[model samples]
Target: MSDLAHLPATQALKLFRTRALSPVELMTAVIERAEAVEPRVNALSETMFEQALEQARKAEHAYVHGEPRPLEGLPVATKDEQPIAGRRASDGSLAYAGHVADTTHPVVERVIAAGGIVHARTTTPEFCCAAYTHSRLWGITRNPWNLDYSPGGSSGGAGAALASGTATLATGSDIGGSIRLPAAATGTVGYKPPYGRVPAMSPYNLDHYCHDGPMARTVADCALLQNVIVGPHPADVVSIRPAVHVPERLGDVAGLRIAYSPDLGNWEIEPDVAANTRAVADALATAGAVVEQVEVPLRRADVMRAAFIHFGAIFGPMVAGVADAHRDELTPYALAFAEDSRAALARDGFLAGLELEGRIYAVIGDLLDRYDALICPTAGAAALPAGEDYVDTKLTVNGVQLDHYLEYSLTPVFNIAGRCPVLNVPSGLSSYGVPTGVQIVGRSYDDATVFRIGAAVERVLPWPTRPQL
Candidate 1:
């Protein structure tokens, strides 16, 4: 019998359906892998071993009777932020450490309804504020490929789990490239469906930025999970109401109107990242995509400043109050950011930031009307050194000192637009052995287009499987 760790969720489910492998057997392998790797990656804050086993046993009974749920017996991972009944859903912050959820979130409920067994909750930055995953509660989530490098956050744990074969499918929530960033950093497939494609209730900002998405080893698996999670939910007023057509086969990229933007026309990019991204762009053209280097007239400084300004305004006050309440517990950076945000607010700076955001969105909308899709590098560079915050580092792009954390540049464009579907597909590997990816941003409500193009690009330079550490 093949080891359960080697089986993809789809294959594992097939085996269960045929009575070839029992859910108990699969659960055993999953738990063993989690226990073995948890110390290394700091991926799981809490493991649902007993609960998962119980659920799997029930699922095995159902399978024997030929009454399997959509995701029956399939083991999966959840982001720490996602509420799972009776599981501690810490958003990777010490403030909420050991806080258990009485009721599961709607997204988790949907996944369970599809027969997916939730075995563990992955790590995230504190309250998911930063892009690199490391929390006082969870320490750090290092990339399985290279322990010296980080798995990008706030979905860093999900990306690493999928890459390391710890889980076949994982759930991720993206606000500003949270899903795609980690996927790019860790060499996994991540999809940020259109803003309302999946149900999301953000206690932070509901205007249009937050989205719940799926991360997987392949595009089809992402589609499988997406098909189950997506649909109108009363909980999410903005959830897509219409039925989305799930593509079964995304063959060839021939005759597709593909537009590639190396730096989205403005931000400075590292040479190696630029070259790796270009190789993927060229592959699209070779595969029959009418690829053209498109110019998106965007002011990089304006967008980044607006995003951070808005981010600070939203999170700053809350953070300050929390720190004031527990001054002894706040991280130095978080405290500094709170003070900075208060200063910005005093200068009437937040209003200007909002206006800038409006202008940037208008410009992007105009560009999408002309081009079918836009492509760019997923990150300024590959995964940075693990455990250290890149914000403190002076990373250069093209001999130019990047102003903000370089990780935030490539993403947040789609977050501001909030209408397109963006996917991070492995383009190539950086010199550091960490993978680099390209971002595919499709037109408004045209999520399938992005998936179609991403699957096509994934065909040319697919990521290789790495066994669990």
Candidate 2:
């Protein structure tokens, strides 16, 4: 039997509404689970025991009084980057290690108003930059499936906690695949809403590529959280006005056109990863979706140029002041990349890249004009072994040597295009016993479509009941 009583928010909500389980009882179980797994996963930085219990007590009263909120009493974890009033909003760096938010971030405020209780701040990469979730302040967040592997980053802790059943649901932010990569690594479901779907106020205003969204063990529960956190804030120009309706139903896939790209046409993908994802396409076909292998037009474009320019813009000014003082502490690759950004990229380059990105986005739009969704592996390999910073370039699959970090190549494309995509289901275990995931790409502003397709795919895919921690 699963020791921590693994329950998704949907079922937990049912019990909460029926008064079958008190909020205190649920909170106790969640806290116990988190405590139980912390030694191995290192997924959480700080647990808000007293505050969470206080909120649970109030939630129990509300439930008994029949005044339940949208998430009434449900336990939720937040990425450490989200500002939580008195709690530290450490971006997993020594630079801002002890900093506290004076007020809650808009998303955190919304979740609180909707009746969710926050118990902890999950770990993140330094300044939320790296693909692996490890930092000087919080150490490393390991995979729930196998403690020796990564859970993905910068929202790595959120994914790890969900997979370990440490919390019912968690929030994740995506900028260059932060949310999706971790979700893929931990075998959880993560969604990247269209740019501005969830209002954000970053110090840098990363409206172009950054997104804050929901992650969970199941789709319906993810939708439940999404329903609560979306809508416009006056401070955010890009936030979409409330979505007219949040989809609760998983649509049938019988007639949907699913474009399957095993390697996204030109990118490098491992053979085992390709085979595992190919099996998903076959499963979708069996589920009655019309599946076809198609070449991604961007694959033929100067993607490396596009990726470098886009990244350089975001990291250039971010580290300009600290590069000299922190040079010794920063990773060699990051320092090298930052120096390159300082030397060459400029405002015109970023604007030009944005313009180019828009044109390429139109190409994807053209493809979506004919197809309902795109399906592919979320990463080229399973989670890397523990303590490994980057996957080895020598790892080859089907005669392909990985060029960049295997995880980024798959999920960063959607971020560049501002598409609403979801990492739906795990393909299954690797020979090393780590988990792998599949990506479901949908059209802009069509997050529900991705959710619908992901739900269907999840039903068809063989989701693991428990990770071998």
Candidate 3:
């Protein structure tokens, strides 16, 4: 059962097809794994074991009758931030700890409709605001690779669960580096599809920077889950038309133009991270792709400012409204974020951010025009302490003080230029055993290209599927 828990969705599906694996058996293994690891990592905020078992039984029936659906019998862990109709959606806030969602997010609905079993709801930082996953409502979500370090958030739990073999497939939402950061830290694969590529819940659905995508142990598995969740939805006005299908076997990247940036022009990347990133570039080069070291016209300050400005202009107010009603119950970080957002809004920071984003995109657009794809270190540093918060912590990369904790993460830049698709693939492990990753950034709406490059990289520099949990 423990071994069964670690099986990839692709392999599990094959087993299901041959009747070598039963959905009930798989779900039971996953639930047992979740129970065993829950105390150490605290990855899941809510468990739906019985519900999952019931679903799994139905999936087994489907398989017996040869009527299996797309994601038939697979166990998936939903990020706590997303709603699952009639289920508790704390969003990692004390205010919503007892709240029940009336309707499901279109992506989760798609997962369920495709026969994916939702066994657990993973944890997130309060309001899904922080990079490290710890909340007043759900406690802290730790890295399975190294328990002292964070798995990364706002999709931290999803990353941890996947790494710990507690879930076969997990859903993640990326705004800034939520999906990719954890994916990098936990040695997993995460995809941040282009804006509107996957439907999101209201409010965030229209926000270009916010995206819902897949997290998995392997690139092919990630693509499998992504294919199910993506596509147009009438509920989300911004959802893309005519969904693009990603191939199960994303073949070679031979003869493709790939550009690699070590620091993105300003970040102070740790030695291990830089080495691993360069190694990935070398592997890509050796794999028959033309990989070159290039500097992107980006500054750490510009990226962080743009992300905060956008968050302040929109998410800040929404969180503020919640804070007003439950002032005392809010997390310290959440309060600080609200206060900072208010200050940014007062100075017309949103418009300033837009101006800077335009300049940043101009440079990125030119780079993408010349190169088929871009690759860079996903996080400047490998990992941080599990409980570290953006407010109190001082992040130092190579002895230089960072302006903010998120400065280490290069993902927010893509959110500012939200049309591009980014995939985070594991590079290697640091001395501390925490994994490092590189982001494969593609041209605007060119989802297939990034996956191709990522798939190529994955094949050349294969990573361990599950963490040492």
TM-scores, in order shown? 0.93, 0.93, 0.98
lDDT of 3 by residue, 1-469 (tens): 7899999999999999999999999999998988888899999888889988999999999999999998999999999888978888778888987889999888889999999998988889999888899988778789999999999988999999999989999999998889999999999999999999999878889898899999999888999999999899999999999999897667799899999999888888999999999999999998999999998878998777777788888888888999999999998888888887777667766678789889989888999999999999999999988887868768888889997788988899899889999999999999899999999999999988899998888888998877776
lDDT per residue for candidate 2 within 1-469, as digits (tens), equals 1443478888888988888788888888888877777899998888897899999999999988989999999889988888888877766767666588787777888889999998887898776776778766777789988777888877899999999878888998987778888887888888887788887876544556788989888878888998898888877777777653467776778888999988765666766677888888998898899999988766623554565577777765576555577666654434555665555455338777777777767767877888988888887776655555553333354465545553234777777777555555677776666767888888777777777777787788758746866
* Evaluation by TM-score, superior candidate among 1 and 2: 1
Model 2 scores worst on lDDT over the 10 consecutive residues at 389-398
* Cα-based lDDT for every prediction: 0.79, 0.76, 0.90
Cα lDDT tens digits, model 1, 1-469, are 2257647677777788889899999888877877777788777766778989999899999998989987888888988788877767656666666678886776788898899998887888877766788867778789987888889888999988887666768999987889998998888889888888888764632657788889988777778888888888777777778858568776777888777888876887777789988998898888888888878788777776676676667767777777788666655556665776676666658788778878887877877777777889988878767887654576666677766673345888888878788888887778878887789888888878888888787677666756335
Ordered by lDDT, highest first, the candidates read 3, 1, 2
Return the TM-score for candidate 1, rounded to 2 decimals: 0.93
The per-prediction CA RMSD against the true structure, in angstroms, equals 2.2, 2.5, 1.1
Ranking by TM-score: 3, 1, 2
Instruction: Give me the runs in candidate 3 sitting further than 4 Å from their true place.
Output: none
| TM-score between model 3 and native | 0.98
Residue pairs with backbone overlap in model 2: 148-386, 271-397
